[model samples]
Target: MRCWAIIPIKGKGEGKTRLAGVLSASERDALVDAMLAHVVQAAGQAGSIERVLLVGPSRHGLDGAIPLLGDPGTGLNTALGAALDTASGGALAAIGAEGPDRVVVIAGDLPCVTALDLDLMAQVPAGTLGIAPDRHGTGTNALSLPLPDASRFIFRFGADSRALHQREAERLGLAVETICSAGLEKDVDEPADLTDAAPVFTPAR
Candidate 1:
């Protein structure tokens, strides 16, 4: 199957605002870039994924090679939906390649994400949806969707996103597979969240 990974990032200096009390602006930017680089590497290494696409205000110099889709200045869900629409519209075919059979939307803050974690999501059955929830099992950390089938799937990235995404899948008659793994659970958000990815962060002082 031709699978692709899409990672959406906030503009370079604007992410991880919840940790404002603990991290300097430069520090926060570095952390965001570091974590994003990690997620991108994992996706590139995943055996099932054919290519990686980024959607956001900027690529933040993480990798000049991967293509980026500009964010519509709306919100996360809208930006993601636009990306799916672009892919499903034959952007690949225009380049003499087959369109992606599946697309996985992965949060850029997952510091510990690995290729195996990504492969698990990419391997979900053709008619099923894969969700990797946060450490609290409340937020959605990553989503694996079969293409064309889930072309119009709405992304609910806010509170209770995990359950809500599952419901969204059910609404489309797709089976939901909750893939919980350590690598997929740790997304650095609050100050306390720093513990989940201490190795990637420099000393606050």
Candidate 2:
């Protein structure tokens, strides 16, 4: 199936505020940039992902290889909704080509996410939604949905988002398949999360 990956990134210097106690403004900015790059690379490397698109305030210092959509600035859900619309050919005709069979929505802060994790998520059967919850099993780290049904899917992405998404999927009568993987479950949000992902943030020798 043709799959498209959409990564929603907050504007530069606008994320990881929870880690302010441990990370300076510049440190947080750099962390966000690094995480975005890692996620983009993993998406690009995933064989199932045909296209990788970014939705954010500005592309700015991004790698520039992937296409970028301006964030609607309404909120996370709005940004994700716009990306889904684009993938459905309702917008961004330049990036829409026959539309994608499946759309994967991944958080930009998943530094540990690998191409294999993405490939596994893409394996969800038709008419089913694949979800990868964060370490605490409260927040959602990754989500995959069929293109036709994605437009109507509600994106509940904060505070117990895993349960919210599961309930929403059930309400929509869609099968929910949980994709559990260490890589997909780890996301950099609070200071503890950052510390846990320290190995990834470190530069190679």
Candidate 3:
């Protein structure tokens, strides 16, 4: 099946405010950059994924290698809406040629996510929604679905996202499957999350 990845990134000094006490402004930005790079690389490495969309503030300085979409500079949910639009063409191709039965949405903060996680999520049966909650079981760290329009969910990346997503799916008459994926559940949002995620980027054991 053909797959695509949509990663939404908030500009430095604009995200992960909870970790500010533990990391300097530069440190937090660096961590975000690293996580984004890792996720993009993993998507590129995944055989099933044909495209990766990096959406963020137009001025965000990501190295030239990654394709970036200029967002309208709004809330996280709005940025995500734009990102999904950017991925539409690829989504259409996947559906028509590559079997767009499902597309994976992963946050840029998930440093621990690996190709294996992608493979597992890809297995979600057609017409089903798969979600991996954050450690708090409130936010959704990763979600996969074959819905023709993923934007219908209206993502709001906050404490109640897990419940919200499920609610949205239920309202749409979509079946939801919650998975306990370690890599997908772990996100670098707090200082502890960053510390825990550092090893994933280090040389393999």
Candidate 4:
């Protein structure tokens, strides 16, 4: 099956605001850029992922190889829905044509995400949905859905999103596979999160 990974990123000025207590304006911008680069690199390196779609404001300084789907400047769910629509609407023709299509939505702030984590998420059986919750196990850090059925579940990304996603999956009668991976769980949101992620945020030598 063909797999497409969609990463939703906010504009530089609008992102990582929660970490303002520790990171300066420039530092937060750099951190967001670095994390975006790392996420894209990891998705590109995943053997199961055929394409990487960036759903965000603009792709000016990002890696040119990955495709960008301009966000509608709405909420997270709306942007994600737009990305999914684009992917399912002929952008990824091979997915449903040959076999089942897999769509993976991941947070751009997961600095520690690796190709292995992506590969594991992609390994979910056909007709099943995979979820990787955040470090605290309350928020969803990553999700894998098998389309077109994937559209049934609404994207509720916030406090207790993991439970919300699971309930949505159950409502749709889709088998839920909860995946736990340290690389996929860690996310930089607060000053403390940044401190914990510092080891992985080193500048490329």
Candidate 5:
């Protein structure tokens, strides 16, 4: 199946605000950059993913050829929804394709995410919704939606999002398959989350 990955990322010097108490502003900024780069590399390396699209400002400074879409200066849910609509509605025409068979939406803050983890999510059965919940199994870290089947699925990224996404998949009449892996489950959010991403916070990068 032709799989595409959509990563919703904040612009430069953004995100990781919850860790402000533990990390200095500069430290948080570096960590955010590191994690976004890691996620983008992983998505690009995934053999099952045909393309990797970023939804955010174009100021990430990734030092690579990447396609970026404007964030619309709104919440993540709204940003991601617009990205999906663009990917499925008419943007494919520009790429000389109809649409992807599977669409994988992965958060940009997952420093631990790997190509294999993304591949696992993309390989879910047709008509199945693949969800990778956070380590606590409460929030969602990554998702794989089967084509037009889930093109309009709502994104619930906050509290209980894992369960909320599952319910949304059911409402869309798609089977739910949970992809659990260390790489896909870890996401740094707060001061307590720093330990999980300590290796990824190289400020000199």
Candidate 6:
């Protein structure tokens, strides 16, 4: 029952288009760093997860603690394909971590995701998939599957990703569970989105 978490991050100055107006350039970059830190911290705490993979293209001034994988110089689909291939081919095999009995793919923008959310995502029954809807309830923020290959659901990040996931799940004949956890639903995408949630990177008291 080993699991891995895949987090795809688009480096700063290129990510979070909607938040540009709400925060200064430095603020946005700092926010991205804080979000990545929170995600890494939560993934480390999730007892169910054995490893965390950061998938994204290489860029200057990018610092993350988890192992980084160079994103394939292609679109989102190709980047994901590369990650799955790594997990399926020999990387995980060599480490004795089998082809993810469970895999959790989470958005890097979600700063509020807690260890509890990771636990819940990893608790799905075998042969089923679990997804957490975004704040608008139209997009996907978190998705968990027993096996990566079983997830043929394409990500359409624009408007109705939730609907797209449901449709794909139905097509693949896989049972799906939809959850709206507070941590999973909120992400820093738009200016209003940041305003809606408190800053996640407060100094330790």
Best lDDT among the predictions, by candidate number: 1
Query: Over the stretch 98-162, how does candidate 4's per-residue lDDT look in tens digits?
Result: 33388999998898889999999888888899999998999999999988777666888988999
* Cα lDDT of model 3 by residue, 1-205, tens digit: 6677767778767767897787777766666777777877777777767766677774246566566767778777787766565455434443343334466888887887888887677677777888889988889887886647454656666779999888877877788898877788888776667666675443222
Off by over 4 Å in 6: 59-65, 90-97, 148-153, 202-205
Pairs in clash, predicted candidate 2: none
lDDT tens digits, residues 82-196, model 2? 7787787777577646688899999888888899999988778999999999898889999999868766888888789999999989988899999999989989877768765
RMSD (Cα, Å) for all candidates, in order, is 1.5, 2.1, 4.2, 3.0, 1.9, 3.3
Candidate 6, residue 133: how far the Cα is off, in Å: 0.4
TM values, all candidates: 0.95, 0.94, 0.84, 0.90, 0.93, 0.86
Residue 72 deviation, candidate 6, in Å?
1.4
- List model 5 lDDT by residue over 21-105, tens digit each: 7777888888888888899989999999998888887647875557776687878998898888877775665545557888999
Candidate ranking (TM-score, best to worst): 1, 2, 5, 4, 6, 3
Report lDDT per candidate.
0.89, 0.85, 0.71, 0.83, 0.86, 0.74
Report RMSD for candidate 4: 3.0
* Best of the candidates, TM-score: 1
- Relative to the unseen true structure, what is the C-alpha lDDT of residue 166 in candidate 6, on a scale of 0 to 100? 76
**What lDDT would candidate 3 get against the real structure?**
0.71
**Clashes in each model (backbone N, CA, C under 3 Å)?**
0, 0, 1, 0, 0, 0
Q: In what order do the candidates fall by lDDT, top score first?
A: 1, 5, 2, 4, 6, 3
* Model 4 misplacement above 4 A: 90-100, 199-205
Cα lDDT for residue 159, model 5? 90
Candidate 1 vs 4: which has more TM-score:
1
Residue-level lDDT tens digits of model 1 in 1-205? 8898999989878899988898888888888988898899999999989989999988889678788887998999999988888778736553345678899999999988899999999999999999999999999999999977898799999999998999999999898899999999989888988887776667558
- Quick one: how many clashes does candidate 4 have? 0
Query: What are the runs in model 1 whose C-alpha is more than 4 Å off?
Result: 93-97
- lDDT score for candidate 6 against the true structure: 0.74
Once model 6 is optimally superposed onto the true structure by TM-score, how far is the C-alpha of residue 136 displaced, in angstroms? 0.8
